[model samples]
Target: MCFKCCLFLASLAFVYFAKAFGGAYMKSSITQIERRFDIPSSLIGVIDGSFEMGNLLVIAFVSYFGAKLHRPRLIGIGCVIMAAGSFLIALPHLLQGPYKYETSVSHNKDVNSTESILPCLSNHSMTEADDTPDLETKTACEKAAGSSMWIYVFLGNMLRGIGETPVMPLGVSYLDDFSREENTPFYLACIHTVGILGPMFGFMLGSYLAKIYVDIGSVDLDSITINYKDSRWVGAWWLGFIVTGTLILLSSIPFWFLPKTLPKQGQEQSESKSKSTELATVAEQENFLPEENQEQEEKEKPVTFQELAKDFIPSLKRLFRNSIFSLMILTYLVAVNGFIGMITFKPKYLEQIYGQSASKAIFLIGILNLPAVALGIITGGFVLKRFKLGVIGAARVSISASVGSFCLLAIQVFIRCENAEVAGLTVSYQGAPQVSYNPQTLLSQCNMGCSCSMKHWDPVCAYNGMTYTSPCLAGCQTSTGTGKEMVFHNCTCIGEMMTPGMNTSAVLGQCPRKSDCDRIFKIYMALSVVGSFISACGGTPGYIVLLRSIQQDLKSLALGMQTLIVRTLGGIPPPIYFGALIDRTCLKWGTKQCGGRGACRLYDADAFRMTFMGLITGLYFLANMLWGGLYIKIVKRQKKLALRNQAKENGQEGNGAVNGHANISIAKNKEDEERTGEESTI
Candidate 1:
């Protein structure tokens, strides 16, 4: 169990630095966006989405292929590729400096300083004026002028994704299979939990590194001035992306020790020997066993890769052709992530319109929205556990969340945009606490009627250039206009972050109207937390459920290839389609079109308000519900068919029945006694 725990941590460590896991891809993609690529936002989202789209299939393949080659060799090669891709992502910097020598610094930490010392060895000359400040800053160049070169970003994701995908399934499966010998789900869960933590920590760590670059590393390379005060408390905010990517790449190295292949030799030998003895006894009892059957029983046969691959393809086909299996896949896909479009794009929308920082938007994304999502899963699980929901339960959960979140997301979009009243905007003489009960309390000088509610202090918001020390006003007044601006005597912005220059003050804006915002915010936060937890809970279990459903009624079907196909198509298509939708919106909107996203657009204050809004929301949910019905019907039919076949197979084992039943029953009595009364025994 302990050994398995170590292996899982190793797998997670690799993913953490490699940036191929969880939100690391999103953060990295955001970096590319910041760097200003020519690619459309949706296209970028699609590419980023592609990292997880075919992950399961990649896992299955790596396990199969890694077994044929050396597992360690495959892992090592993948890591090297991942490292190379990471380097390419930082290429714009390398190109402005030295490419060859920079490549040599793959294993070195002093990479930035090394290049400065070797100035004569620069591979490319700088084109920007000395006053340009940052020669590597993509903003200096046209956004798309070098956006085509952003393929480096895409490749970075691809290489990292491909290399890390297999670790989850194979690694967990490895622990599950091996640990069963000692009776431990503890190891499996522990290892997987670590995998989950990797992403969170990776982000925190990367955010830290990003600050170091701006504050420490960039000092010698660029002409930026760094005052001691700035260095003492600055968190530039880029720390999360850079540090996460760097650490994920470095940490992925330890998966080298995990077992590559299953204990196939032992299982094969046991099966062969056990079957041989049984067949010989049967023959002797019959007094006339076939000589050929006896010979076949004693001789083990080797299956070639060509034969194995051939069988795997048909198995996959049979699984997919089964109506029930197909339904399961469809329903599950839509249920949990059908509204992925809303989830992914919503953040971008908030950032553009409200001028909200990414952190603030992430915080504002309303908790309850996600919680409603969790309740759906728990409801589905309840029906399954208590009412035998089976595949039906899974379908119900998926369809419900998919359809429901779709609607709720539309409402969320509306509240933030169309219905937003600017709700008494007043500047604070001093920055207010993130959570406040009184709106007017933020700006104490405001003579407007108000209510003060929160009991807290410390500022996370700063406007313009000056800092005001006076107490703020608190209010609950109704605004007369659609928008209102309150001026401050002088408000200064303070920057603090996970890294330097991070603008930590944003975290201080708890609830704009603590009473109202908190009411909405709490509900929203609950729902969102619920949603993420619920969705996460369903994912692996749901993956297993759908996989099993495909096999049912498809008796002895080859599933290896189907696993690859289903995982690839299911994961890839949605992101592609979602990205496409966003891009189309971008083309029609954007004045600036940051990376073709229609960024900071006029209509984004209300994206779905245009003609097809309701219909699009309704239609997405409606389709999800339809798939749900189809899934339930299929799962039922498959189970019924599988059982019928099972009965038929049992009937073939006749004649030795009476004596066999008596001896079997007697052996079971002893077997039960020997194994029982021990809680820890496997």
Candidate 2:
């Protein structure tokens, strides 16, 4: 039995691991997906939130009815569905022939050709008709828009969410039902611990994959102009889905063989009345009952839909009537809003605000931050179990953790890096940094005759520590080697900024941030790690408060309702609104192949930092405020319950003392009467 139970646990853990890995990998690949599809952050946010919408559609039904069904088989079915969804998410990569990025240069031309297509010289010959795209291009653009391959990813992710709903509620309840009460927590902890490792490996996988080109085998890597660090780079984001999907499929196999139910663990030694005792009492009642009573006993039937419907409303009311439970849900909802939005965009934040590559950002989060969270969760559970904290005690622990983490998070707003020096965006053509610029500002004396297109975003780094929007914008009239090694000679704009006798050539790609930004990034990461760990330490304790505050019989309903409400409201809206707000800070938007705005190629670093961090901080502040109120409510309720119990105990003791005195007096009176009767008789 123990071995079988262990097998079940191992299977469940593997399923948990696969799902978590897939989810994290999806988040880690957000930037890649955004670039691949040429979509805005707000649209990507919608795709990300689709998973929650799917869960919202089916969570309530699954939570209530799934327990009565064969839980293992149900979980197995969910896994298969999740696997299908994973495969579907990868379908877009197969359908979309190859990613085509906007560029001004012709890579197909020979590098050794004597005749060079100089961007600055060539711009003089471009007429009005040449600027407008032809009919073929317009038709292709219409076709691309009609296809909208990202819908597949959204649907696949939604399916994954729907499938995942059954795993947590059913699996946890099943384990609790069959396992010994003392061992349940240990089992759950083991599963969660193993589950956390999935995200670690998932992010690591994402980091590794992000360094490789998206169309790796099909395309020539040598011809690609962008490196992994470039904003336009698209990694093999779809591959992780296939790998994780297979794992989820394989994880489902063991569940089919497991029994629907198991004999309660340690049932033989259990002091409480067991199932067999109840059966024996029923047998005795049947033997002694009258014929009509026997008939009535026979009329006992299986529970029907109407009975369940009748019970649900009152159960819901009972669950919500607990003020602590309602407040806990509200606090969690507010906290989760901050958490979801922050995590979804944290990689983007690192890349824009701190000058970290997407790969490096994901790698750091996996190795440094996620481990801290794992440790914090373990510590929280240990502290709660070791100290055996009650509802009020748990609330205090969560509040302390929240306040500490909030302070640490607030400190991070000041730890920021300066904006990157990009020509025509953050800086002028003459090397002067500016807070804002218009499209006309991209033109200057050096590049005015060149007529550079502001829509194109082929960045080139000049010798004078400045980045131009393109070689033409830099007034470069000379050739480049090829791809990443390409460089332009006689850049007029670069010469204006350089000292006399200095070379006026420019290299491919934007210039990296200054060395001091690296130091700032490291500090930001350290503070982030500390804050994440501190916040995670409150997770398990806060959960315990929710569990303790609700009615025992309505525990499942309460949990299900909480999941539905929090996920529907908190999970779905945060990303959309956060992404929309962040989009306002885009310094340069990428141009699509069809002559429309694409994903943002560059963001205003200062604005991006303030917006992203400010939104997260404000949400956390509100969450902390809610947590404070929740703590106060828990304390008040605890005190009232304590006082009420004490009064009841005092009243019972007083009544017992009065009854004892009355009995003693009655005994004495009987004895006195007996003595008087004896004297009279004498």
Q: Pick the candidate with the highest TM-score.
A: 2
lDDT per residue as tens, model 2, 132-212? 577898778747654388899999999999988888878877776667644554566667778888888889999999998
Worst 10 residues of 2 by lDDT: 673-682
The C-alpha stretches of model 2 lying farther than 4 A from their native spots are: 109-115, 125-139, 144-147, 179-186, 268-302, 647-682
Global fold similarity of model 1 (TM-score): 0.55
RMSD of each: 14.9, 9.7
- TM per model? 0.55, 0.89
